[model samples]
Target: MTLAKGPLFLLVLTALALTSCQSDDKPPQPRFTSDASGSQVGKASQREGQYFIEFRSRYALTYGHTYAVFGRLNKAGGMINPQVAGLAPASADAAPYVLGHFIPVPATTGATDGDLEEAYRSASWRILLTEAEYNKTVAFIRQLQAKSKLWQATVDNCNNFVGEIAGSMGYKTPSIWLRPQEFITKLREMNT
Candidate 1:
């Protein structure tokens, strides 16, 4: 059957997409335990203080969120001292999510509530970092966070945020408008 197109259709489609991403009724874990690669403590870096960055896209269907995760690595190449960040509207209310569809809204960077929740990750790309690279990347993230004041869903949205971070890390990013998962998957494909 052919599909209908209009405001109501869009609303219903969005509702279905969002609803499909709801958790499987299982409660989230107490704390984030692993990076997107799956190993947290097992893949320590070649040296102490070495670091890693992983760009991730979490579920919400086409509206899924994208963010970056970084951390120190122990001598064994496993991740440690993990940190996360992303660009998003300052509020978690439906208003921002919806309003962002039209205009820019006050935004914040640094980890939001779901950044550490491993269960939401639908796509990710990771890279090991040297001490120098780690320091620079972290500094860049801070600067980006400080300067980024607004988030517009169709403009400088989450994928743009993650893509900016990825670009700083020297990875070629896919188009920012792609769904979070597709953007992330393309990121890995282009880089690796």
Candidate 2:
């Protein structure tokens, strides 16, 4: 049968529009995954820029404590001493840097001052760092390898190695979910 021009033209136009719209076969999914890989924690030390502290043990996503730690580091100028203000607050941000982030060495924590070396050696491995986190930590040690010259500026290993370096430089607090690109902004700021 012969078709009318107006209806036929409308049908063809509609079909073309539909085909083009359907090209994007699947609607975009959230791409959510429980895995931490590909996330910021996975790319630790990809650049020699700022460092970041992962939760000593990956905390539940719902937990606010991890963010508290991040905030403490950011606010404390990168060194949250465990003896800060009577360990004032119970939350990670308020307490002296103990628990997950650091070992409560009497020296580091300002409890006793006999031999810090022994304390560090004993406490270093006590924190629950992952293989990747541990590796970055080791690299941090090598970076801060004790200097002989007392006059030379001390390499801030506490800042660099413990992942507080980023906080020290200043970008934003609680950047636990910060991407590499985001971390770089702090690096640039510190360098400049």
Counting clashing residue pairs in each candidate, in order, gives 6, 1
lDDT of 2 by residue, 1-192 (tens): 356887776566445433322321112111111112222222322323222332211111111111102111223223233211011112334233222222222112111221122221111111223456545644443343332111100121122222342233232333222222222233333323
Measured against the true structure, the TM-scores of the candidates, in listed sequence, are 0.73, 0.19
Query: What TM-score does structure 1 among the candidates reach?
Result: 0.73
lDDT of 1 by residue, 83-124 (tens): 878888888687886776655789988777766676786776
The parts of candidate 1 lying over 4 Å away from their true place are: 1-48, 75-78
Among all candidates shown, the one with the greatest lDDT: 1
- What is the number of residue pairs that collide in model 1? 6
Models, CA RMSD each: 7.2, 22.8
